[model samples]
Target: MDKHHKINIEYAKKLGLKSALVYQYVKDMNSDTKLHTIIEEFPYLSNEDVGNSIKSLVEQGLIEFNDDNQIITLSSTIQKTKIRTPISNRSNKIDKSWSPSEDAVEVLQRAGVDAEFIDGLLDEFIIYWSERSSTLVSYNSKFIEYCRLKWAQHTAEIDTKSVPRIIDKNWAPSEDCLDIIKMTGIDDAFVRLHLPEFILYWKEDGRAFVSWDIKFLDFIKNKWNYNVEVTSKEHTYKFDLFDPYADDEDKSKKSTKGNIKDLRKKYKI
Candidate 1:
């Protein structure tokens, strides 16, 4: 009926209403529950305004409650719905019961999240902004190191006792897997120990090979002027021991971001 009431009505629409609750409460000429309930839940309205609006709805016969019996009866069953009318023109055209969107329809069936929470996220303006905002693919130096270690462990899962013939085909390692190998810094013999006999023989069982094309090792070499060759390729064809990122150098050079901005934003979201 007025500006304040208009805002509350819109706000309340997001919160699902139980038809039985509204009808029973409205039936009572003097509701015992503090009028503060409407204001508190909405938080967008003052106590006086929310109380008076509920009173107005009662006066206008929009809601009807019998306080003594705790019975709620709506003047029109349609009047008690959370949605004022319909979400779209097509909805008005359908005489048959409407099915929610593929997503919206799930709420009536599932219990994972409250329907109101999902609805708010799907509001037109919110959806529009979300579509525009870019999502991040997170990466960390230590986490990358962990992945390489895990990859070594993962490959070890293959059995050494498989049908023993050198296969004609070899699968090129994934880029991430290769990066792990580069970062791992394990001795070639250690690398061989982790590999299945099949992988070793599929190439050449007699030789374990390591070659250094890694740029990071060179960066460490020049900056600290540690001429110590950390790069090693332990091969049956050739073998050498080197410390690419040796223990002697300062560990502080490893990049740890001054700020973890992405993690902070994700926490806020």
Candidate 2:
């Protein structure tokens, strides 16, 4: 099977899980299908979701719609047919000011990233790798993953304004809760099983109301200092795009797939 077709099928399934109408619209969309046609057909959808769904499909290379053409069409990837388009003259250019493509920007936006900081975040990622070595790896996928990290960092910095409402002002960890948790053993599963207890204890006594799941896990790891026997999964190294291909660079740095692996593991990407 074609790689692009496989990718579209996977992404379509993901979109389907969100909204069946959106999924069907994506699966059936072609150059002749107008945006208004979709809107009229799926009246239950908000214009924003419909628009977002379209953009997401485009970003994933399932579809394409240029502003000048105003025609929605299956992307070459989705169609499994090539349509010749003007190739960029600067495709081989080497410049310090290079930025991610529009597809990359759409991806960041879909991930709920703030637009203003995207360039800065990309620059930061590039500079981080540049300083370590001249070689770069996994330009598109890694950069997409980088955008996710930046979004996470950005959200974490800006604390949520919603006040933490106590579920029960007088709530205390019951003896049963403690006993069950203890019996569950000191592991991540134990913490997950008694998350309510952890939340109440943290809010009431620890004075920490963690909102992120990762942060909550870290808190449990630190507070309990318990070892969980988590089996480490094998990491598959893939490099689809690398700019200024580092053919002559030292193999050690140029082929340091571990750098990206370490990053993925650290951020749980």
Candidate 3:
């Protein structure tokens, strides 16, 4: 394996996830591998085992899954990926910069005070401090709507965007609480019906929420040709917007598609 791959696998192992997850997520471009594909790629793990691992990593905040994109992805960017070089090659070493916080700790250390806490102060700690100080939060509604859709590119699991978050000090879901998703099935239904406008939003109080337009639900229900329920076995996500040109009655009253009516010389098809 290349040195980068070796580093990625080591990181993945630290989080109890498959090394392939690190490979897929750590590369520069966006990814589209679904959870099923991930499980399939790592043949040794069973579905249940993979599912458990997902729960664990999501809780750890090391990775998140875009249901719409179908990939387990890394969120932490602190660790640098190392590239391999020739055996005889020598490279200059980069030095870590000193910040005010580091300076304070160093002064304390010189005075014989405890400065060890600074060792745990990483760039991520600053992220936490910013969130806490400003009461800002990542409301899932935005992620569910944009990030998930762009990544998954599928309509069915697109509702996974609505999957309620366990955003907290520990991000894992409680057993019965998670089962609520499985038994209720309504959120999943809404995801399927109105995915075009699903949104994840954060409130002013540092809480995140997800929502979509209900009028869209009414519009689709009134316009849909078939008997479609959330769990309906015959449902499809295809919309009629892209069909061959058909004249609308109101528009045709003011205009015409055939040669005779008006302004034909001024227009081109």
Q: Per-residue error at 21 for model 2, in Å?
A: 31
TM-score for each predicted model, relative to the true structure: 0.17, 0.33, 0.22
User: How would the candidate models be sorted by lDDT, starting from the highest?
Assistant: 2, 3, 1
Candidate 2 accuracy as TM-score: 0.33
Clashing pairs in 3: 34-70, 68-152, 69-151, 69-152, 140-200, 141-199, 141-200, 141-201, 142-200
Using lDDT as the measure, which candidate wins? 2
Local error of candidate 2 at residue 140 (angstroms): 2.6
**Per-residue alpha-carbon lDDT of candidate 1 for residues 222-258, written as tens digits (9 for 90 to 100):** 4323322333322432433565566545453332332
Off by over 4 Å in 2: 1-98, 133-137, 156-159, 162-205, 209-214, 217-269
Give lDDT for model 1: 0.34
Superposed model 3: Cα runs more than 4 Å off: 1-9, 17-30, 68-71, 76-269
Q: Estimate, for each residue in 1-269, the C-alpha lDDT of model 3 and write its tens digit.
A: 01122335565567645633544443433543345444433434444455556655555565565543234556543221221111112321111331233333443345333334334443434444344423211112111222222222222224446653322432322232222222222233443444333222112234442322222233333433233353464334354445444556657755555444345555632
Clash number by candidate, in order: 12, 0, 9
Q: In model 2, what lDDT does residue 152 have? A: 53
